[model samples]
Target: MFALISLSDLENDFINPYDLTQRLNRFVALEYATQVVLVAVLLLGGKWFLAGLQAAMLVYLLHSWHVKQHTVDATDVFRQLPVQKKRRLIMFGSFLLFFVIITYRFIESIIHGLLTEEGRAHAKKLFQDAAASVHGY
Candidate 1:
């Protein structure tokens, strides 16, 4: 099958010798390489996106603050705001999506780092101890 051949190719390229230590070392090396690539992309590709988001949020906050300062009542500014349900939903959804993406990335990094045999063993022991305490086993 094609999948088997692809797996064989990857094995030959990256894990041919079936040595755990070598594989772990290789994984760490690749992780460093990926970190470099991610830093480069964040610097080059993410800069503009971050800047635009910062500007938009800053402008909105400043406008709200100015309105509050000018008004005598604290809740006056909020009362004057228009209820654009569609825009509010879009912003809320986008924020939730961003949070989910960040959380997923964090979990992925943790799982990937703990994929090595030693790391897995440590994680297993930690979880087992926690489970034992919870179950009073």
Candidate 2:
């Protein structure tokens, strides 16, 4: 994984048609990347920014459909793959899917936890100030 990311030729790395087909790997990678970005923005409290990013990603994917048929091409990728590579691609894709989902959930929990904690602290402080004022402190 480290070596994969460190590779200078990211396009070449992602285009592997053997163990991990470019279609499956590329699609998963792009989705995972977008999800991570979304969660990161959510953690940073950039709700509006994340929404805009989502809209942009949607538009980009939609616009690119005319140039390339990813779904049909994915079938070709599968058909051309050797048996062993097909098995590996299936296992790798399943694992990648699980990892992406788990990571997103974990990030979501962290963001929710942070926001709830902050809200509680803010309410507590507000209450303390109100009580102090009432008591002329």
Candidate 3:
């Protein structure tokens, strides 16, 4: 029984598609990180403002959509499989979803930062500079 179990474990490692899927799954987290940093740059009481935030969000959403669609396309191939296979699919899907959610919350933190009194005070100078540039005065 021990030998049989050991063989099974080896077989799993050798045959599991997760080895490939995990490599691809890494890209999902990478996308989330990229989006978070861009959001921070746009909203973290620095140089950018609402316009930059919007642009960053748009770009991130587009990239996320593309990756999600690709995942869906790949998932369709296994749609007819059994529960066990479906469970594995769900696990990977949730991993990507969780990272994306975490990234969004990070962006929300930046929004909170901007809404605070101190952050608003910082924004005032930025707005004044924008006004001066716009009016060329």
Candidate 4:
């Protein structure tokens, strides 16, 4: 819901309502598709919590970049409103903090995973499979 709201704000500048709706729908579809792929990757990697956090952070970062581009192209009136500016800054700051925390957690998880016996076995199998494939080529 929040994602849709942010996407709508980013797309609000379109002059045609039909075009705006189409673009929003496209974005929503694309986001869903990307998330499905991320979920598949997470499942394969077996780091559900950390990988999911990273995926969410990546999505937020992409959405923020999209919104920032639209805001940059906005008129001075849109850009200078103190209320809007404050709201945007607060939201961006909060998200940035979350992003940092998630990233730290992700790195920590990677190191922890590598230190575990099961993780080492998985890594060894992966490497062996890769080597076998290379030899086959």
Top lDDT model: 4
lDDT of 3 by residue, 1-137 (tens): 22223224434665344443444445655655665665676566554544364454556456546755323222332332243244345444544665686588789988998999999888898899999899875
- RMSD of every prediction: 25.2, 13.4, 16.5, 10.1
- Give model 3's clash tally: 0
Error of 4 at 111 (Å): 1.4
Better of 2 and 4 by TM-score: 4
Order of candidate numbers by TM-score, starting with the best: 4, 1, 3, 2
Residue 35 in model 1: lDDT: 39
Which prediction has the highest TM-score against the true structure? 4
**Which whole-number lDDT from 0 to 100 does residue 39 have in model 3?**
63
- Residue 65 alpha-carbon offset, candidate 1, angstroms: 6.3
- lDDT score of model 4? 0.58
Model 1 Cα lDDT, one tens digit per residue, 1-137: 22223234433564342332232234434533543454466557665554454345445435544654212122232232222223334445545665676688789989997999988999999999999899975
lDDT of 3 at 21: 43
Indicate the residue-level lDDT of 47 in model 1. Answer: 57
lDDT, candidates in the order shown: 0.48, 0.51, 0.52, 0.58
- Residue by residue across 1-137, what tens digits does model 2's lDDT show? 32233222333555443334443455644654665566566557756644554555445444445555322243365453443344335434544765676689688976776588786787689889999999984
| Alpha-carbon runs more than 4 Å astray in model 4 | 1-80
Off by over 4 Å in 1: 1-56, 59-83, 134-137
